[model samples]
Target: MRPLNKGAKRQRVRRDPAPSRLFYRWQRIWLTPLYRRLISLGLPMAALVAGGHVLWSDPDVQAQVTASLVRARESVERRPEFQVQLIRLQDVPDDLATQIRQAANINLPISSFHLDLDEVKARIEEIDAVREVSLFLRAGGVLEVVIDQRIPVVIWRGAKQLEMLDAEGIRVGYLDHRTDRPDLPLLAGQGVGPHIGQALEILDAAHPVADRIRGLVRVGERRWDIVLDRGQRVMLPEDDAVRSVEHAMAMQMTQDVLSRDISVMDMRDARRSILRLSEAALEERRVQQAIAKDVDNNL
Candidate 1:
């Protein structure tokens, strides 16, 4: 083993010290521009080849692309904001869900791209009590739908089948409200629109007014008539029916007219009123009074 003596090493280096920087020894480095360019380009070229090998050589590229596409589709479909919700005047019944789904035509191709609001609204209105529809597109691709329902105010008890009509005389077709509606007045014959509408209006104006209306029947275009709930008929003269109805109402209140078992309240004469009771009804009333008298005499 040789001992390292600072003195010996200093004597060897004292004459001239080696260059402090390694590159300082290469005096001609800047002179070779071609070499510099090649050296600089070498690293990027290797990286480019390596990247190309990774991109093209792998058999899983197609699978990865397909997987990405599937994920994108699933992500869109599963998003909470994209879920569709619907409501009706009544919540849609599960039993009718199939019918509603069919009516919506969701799977139809062109339905997605094109919209016909007027047509859709018109179709929806065709339903028995549907009054309004609201539709909106959700952010994640879902659609929200809502419906408003109409209330029936009159009964169109025609010869064939009974239908529910609104104040405007619009038919609402067979419905579940028949039990409740039966308590309402029944329009026996055809051409009972404005009459029924007028009756409902008057009835709505004040409580018990509607209950007194009984029913309105259309006799030819020449005349109109109203039937009281008490099984009496009131003939209204042709023309100014509104005034006639109002007059009849006032006369009824003044006379306590409806309070009696009056047969009819004829407003046709314009100057006078007529009353007619059915023979059977009069007989029944007479019998009821006789029974009351007999009971009073015994007491």
Candidate 2:
């Protein structure tokens, strides 16, 4: 029943946090040494501004820039592909350049052959040509390459595949892409060539057939099936395939037996030749032998 107070007492006002003042104090502390040092040195702010420009504005950079450009130009000229300049590489001594100019000392009608872009690329890859390469104008006034001949790995028939391999069994290429250079032996079925140098050696040493074979395929794991230009398969055995191949090759030349349409001449048999006749040829020969036997009995 006593008089009730209706008005509320005033609330204390909240103060804002003085984070900026504290940060300023820290900033002053941190900067004190640097500012004092500058003041003691009597160094002017304008001097620092001038020194920065002097250190950064280097004229030597221009020389470095020019030298880099010169190296780039020289490198481009060095490549045989770009005809910008004939460099030290162009006049290679005792190389293909020398061989092509002198290789024909053994041959009569030929003195030198000119080299073209395509020929230049191919001849340089050869081992014996000294990788010698030279440029010459071809019949059509096109670029041609001349080089000393390489020792052929073997004679190749171009009708079958794309690459020509060397005697040691190094692959060149097929598709006649580079024709300015001379051709090498044709080889095929190089699927097993993943074994590298050894596989090629096997092909190189593979008897007389190695020389006469037109195409070769790696068969199974350890054998080879060689095809002659006459369209016959000469099956070389696993062991001493080289010598077995020699006997078969001798038979081909001596008996002239490869002239027949044959499917396979298996030299895999150690002692005898296993002949696989073409189906059509086999059928015809069977019929003729039967007729000859019947005629003989009647007589």
Candidate 3:
């Protein structure tokens, strides 16, 4: 080996300015918009997932979290604004109001959040007299229940008992006796429930003989016979029963035919009216005819 002079300086080697292959590839990937977004969003989401998994792995921590949620919910639900302290019924009678309260079965000072309005409405509508009902939580902690009660227009005397029915033929309530609802028109016999509208119309047309009307009987499930006082019946046809009744009323008003000793006024034939006399009236009529015949022969 040759020895170098002490004054001579060693030359420095030059390095490349570009990055390595691995580092260059990583830089290109980092510059990509999708990659950058993934890194930005995925890290926090992974961290959150890991943290949640660890937190919920413990039973005590899970219970605490559930309790905290329940308390939060209860805090909002127990607010005074959400509490129901009273129940007010609208458009309901006192007797029915008592029954509706019993049906509601609600505890006072309860949270409105726990009350099921639909369920309460269903309960109240179970009553026979309730036609329709609506329920809502009003201001000032009042639970208002509005009710539409059925109005009874007629009394149906069934084979078993008497039932008060509305105009639609739906039962309002049951009555112990006919005298309980004397204001409403009485109806009897089979298949009258479905034809109550016609019966009502017939009764309306018989207003001239309203005082003598006892009831109406459904004959053969097709026709109606208006039963009047003194065993008198106005037999009406199946169709145009209102007109038939009107004709009978006109006869009663003009000729006082219904006031005679007639047992039945057969208005079944719209063309003509037939009067079936009572037994006594028939006997008297036969005696008069016999006397007339004997007088003619003598002449």
Give lDDT tens digits, candidate 1, residues 17-93: 55657566453553577766655787689889999888867779867878999888777665555444432323654
Tell me how many clashing residue pairs each candidate has. Answer: 1, 14, 0
Per residue, candidate 3 scores C-alpha lDDT tens digits across 131-174 of 88988789999999889999998898888999998888899999
Decoy 3 TM-score against native:
0.76
Whichever of 2 and 3 has more lDDT, that candidate is 3
A best-first ranking of the candidates according to their lDDT comes to 3, 1, 2
lDDT of every predicted structure (CA atoms): 0.63, 0.57, 0.92
Better of 1 and 2 by lDDT: 1
Top candidate, metric TM-score:
3
Q: Could you list the CA RMSD of all candidates, in the order they appear? A: 14.3, 20.8, 6.2
True-structure RMSD for candidate 2: 20.8
* Candidate with maximal lDDT: 3
Estimated TM-score for each candidate: 0.51, 0.42, 0.76
Q: Which stretches of candidate 1 lie over 4 Å from their true place?
A: 1-102, 105-122, 131-134, 176-178, 182-185, 194-196, 202-213, 221-223, 280-299
For 73-109, candidate 2 gives per-residue lDDT tens digits of: 6676544443322212343345544544343222222
